[model samples]
Target: MKAMVYRGPYKIRVEEKPEPIIEHPNDAIVKVTLAAICGSDLHLYHGMMPDTRVGMTFGHEFIGVVERVGPSVQNLQPGDRVMVPFNVYCGSCYFCARGLYANCHNVNPNATAVGGIYGYSYTCGGYDGGQAEYVRVPFADVGPARIPDWMSDEDAVLLTDAMSTGYFGAQLGDIVEGDTVVVFGAGPVGLYAARSAWLMGAGRVIVVDHLEYRLEKARTWAFAETRNFAEYDDIVVELKRSTGHLGADVAIDAVGAEADGNFLQHVTAAKLKLQGGSPIALNWAIDGVRKGGTISVMGAYGPIFSAVKFGDAMNKGLTLRMNQCPVKRQWPRLFEHIRNGYLSPSEIVTHRFPLEHIAEGYHTFSAKLDGCIKTLIVP
Candidate 1:
């Protein structure tokens, strides 16, 4: 098998590797049909996530066909096309019993915070990802579901992470009817968050980014107002002015670790590895939303200290909610949204790369070149 092997920061290559075999009674070996490079993967690519071993693969969003299953995996079998959620967890665990699969206690040894995530890092349970030709899926009965006949492979793959997480971001916002929502970052997750805000009855949606192409996507695809943060003297003040001096009712931080508005924050966190992640976007979220409003953090941040505005949040009485999305929990509503023509997950895909060209795919997305919004890996 050929898999994308990470050598160091900003280094990855396709190399021959041993094929995966079922290791647990509830495990299933999947032949990957489609996979995606998530923005969170960039954290590992840039050496932000700790314990991301040199040889580990990085991907958490994928859909595949069950090539084989262990004896205990009764829900899936050979030839079953399935979409696996990014989270790896046992369904009967304490957290999983309450539908908090992303925090399942029975998966990761360091399960104090996040549960197992495919290909994230050893910090998230050292599981190999589906970026290669085949991936071993644990707790097969709980995490994967048969891809609906009507869903395209692209949609199925995106649903595993980006779309689901975006929807979860909006859900966490607790948006009320006619509320105004602001989503920072126009990446796939931000775009989906903006669009999902509309479906949740938000009267206005605004997307902020530094790139023209992504802001353009926000306007056209997400039907949201756009702001290029680079063009503003103070983006937070601009946001407040746009929302009539009260600021947005809800704000979602979709740009994590690498947010670039503040030069010092970006350098300290992203370049110097001094902070867990760049808190510019999240800090902006704290400063841009109205007092007593809600903030939903969909962005992935390392488990380390970050210089955030906790005092201001406390003073303003803002409700802060965040989590690694329980991906499978969002699927039922997303399925209905897709079937009803309210969402088109595949429309955000901008590039496709064969398994052999994964490095090029990573470069294109990392550099934000070629108007790249999303890239798919076909095995």
Candidate 2:
């Protein structure tokens, strides 16, 4: 079997690995059909995710067809097409019972971590992910859902992370009917966040980013009002003006920490840098929002500390919330929506590549070239 292995920073290789089999009675073997690169994968690719450097398969969001099922897997059968949830969890844990399946105690013993994540570290329950010709899926019966016959893998793969995380950002922002929302960054996740805000009945969605392509893309989605940071004097002021000077009911830091490298990047950076999990966006989000607004950070974050102004974030009376989506917890409802045609994540996937062309896909996605909103790795 061939797998894309993450050896170190900016390094990936297609290497031969042992064919996966049904390892446990509760496990199933998936013959991967399609997979997609995620913004979260960029952290590992850039060597920013400390514990995930080596010994990882390098993909989390994927869709595959079940080739073999465990003896105990009653609901799912071979030949079933399913979207594998990023986080693997047993259904009966204390955390799962409370609907916090991402933080399942049995799957991930670490209190600091949520659910055991695929392609991540042991802290998240080191499970094999669906980034290869074959992958072992433990607890497969719990969350895998069949892809509708009408849906293509290319159309469904992007939903695994982009839509889920985007919706996660909106949920974190406490979206409500007629709420004014400001989403920072125009990456795929940010685009989805803007859409999620609208889906949740937000009055206005203002997206701030320097990329003209993304701003234009957001406009096509009717994602709030778009702002190109490079073309604006003060996004906060502009957002206020657009929102009747109330600021936004929600100012979300979807940029996470790395969307801008330093505070200068907030307004005056001379070059474009890949922004994933930068801390500067936090303070900017705090300053950009209303006094009582919420600042939700759906970007992938590490434990390492970054510099921020306590006085501003505190005095502004802002609420802060950050987390990876408890994807399994939302799968049933979200899948239902997808099945019912209420959600169309396919609009975000503008790029696709075969497994061998992954490097080019990464470069294009990383560079955000030619309006490359999202990329899929067709296995």
Candidate 3:
């Protein structure tokens, strides 16, 4: 099997690796048909995440055909076409029973925080991801769902992470009808969050980013007002001015570790590895939202302290809600939305790479070249 192996920071290559086999009674070996390079994967590519060992494959958003299933995997068979959520969990755990599968206590040894995530790092449970021809899925019955007959492979793959997380961001916001929501970042998650805000009854949506291309996508695809943070002297002030000086009703941080607005924060977090992740987006979110509003954080961050505006959030009485999205929890509504033509997840896809050229795919995406919004790898 050929898989993308991480050698070091900014280094990855497609190489022959041993095929995965069922290791647990609830496991299934999936032959990956479609996989996506998520924006969060760049954290590993750039050495932002801790304990991302060399030779580990990095990918979480994927869909596949089950080639073999363990005896305990009763819900699926060898020939089932399935979409596996990024989370790896046991369904009967205390957290899982409460629909908090992303925090399942029975999966990751380091269950103090996030549960097992496919191909994230040792901190999130060192599970191999599906950035290859084959991947072993643990707790297969709980995580892998059969792809709906009406769904396309591209859409199914994106739903595994990006779309689901975006919707979860909006869900966390608890947007009231006619509320103004501002989303920071215009990546796939940001775009989806902006779009989902509308579905949640937000009267207006604003997407903030530095890239013109992504901001354009925010305007067209998400139907949200766009702002280039680079163009503003102070983005929070600009957001406040745009929202009639009170601030937005809700703000979401969709850009995590690599946020670029504050040069010092970016350097401290991304370049120097000082804090967990740059809190520029989150701080902007806190400052951009009105008093007593909500702030939803869907961005991926490391398990370390970040210099955030906790004092200001407390002063303003903001409701801060966030989690590594319970991907399967959002599937039912997402399936309905896709079925009704409300969303075409694949429309965000801008590049496709063969398994052999995954390095090129990573480079293109990491560099944000060729107008790449989303890149898919066909294995």
Candidate 2 clash pair list: 102-115, 116-124, 205-224, 257-277, 257-278, 257-279, 258-275, 258-277, 258-278, 259-275
Per-residue alpha-carbon lDDT of model 1 for 263-372, expressed as tens digits?
A: 66556665776665677899999999999999999899874465689999999999999999999999999999999999999999999999899999999999999999
Task: Name the TM-score of candidate 2.
Answer: 0.90
Q: Count clashing residue pairs per candidate.
A: 0, 10, 0
Against the reference, the lDDT scores of all candidates come to 0.92, 0.76, 0.92
Give the least accurate 10-residue stretch of model 3, judged by summed lDDT: 261-270
State the displacement of the C-alpha of residue 180, model 3, in Å, after optimal TM-score superposition. 0.3
lDDT of 2 by residue, 1-379 (tens): 8888877767777778898888789888888899888877776676655456475787788889899998999878999998887878788888778777667777766746677888875556777677788889888778677887877676567666778878888988888799988888888888888887887889888888898878888888844688887776766677777777767889877676446565553222122223224576676687788887888987776553455666787888888887777775555556676778777788778888888777777778776776787888877
Query: Per-residue alpha-carbon lDDT of model 3 for 136-161, expressed as tens digits?
Result: 99998889999989899999999999
Model 1 ranges with Cα > 4 A deviation: 261-274, 304-306
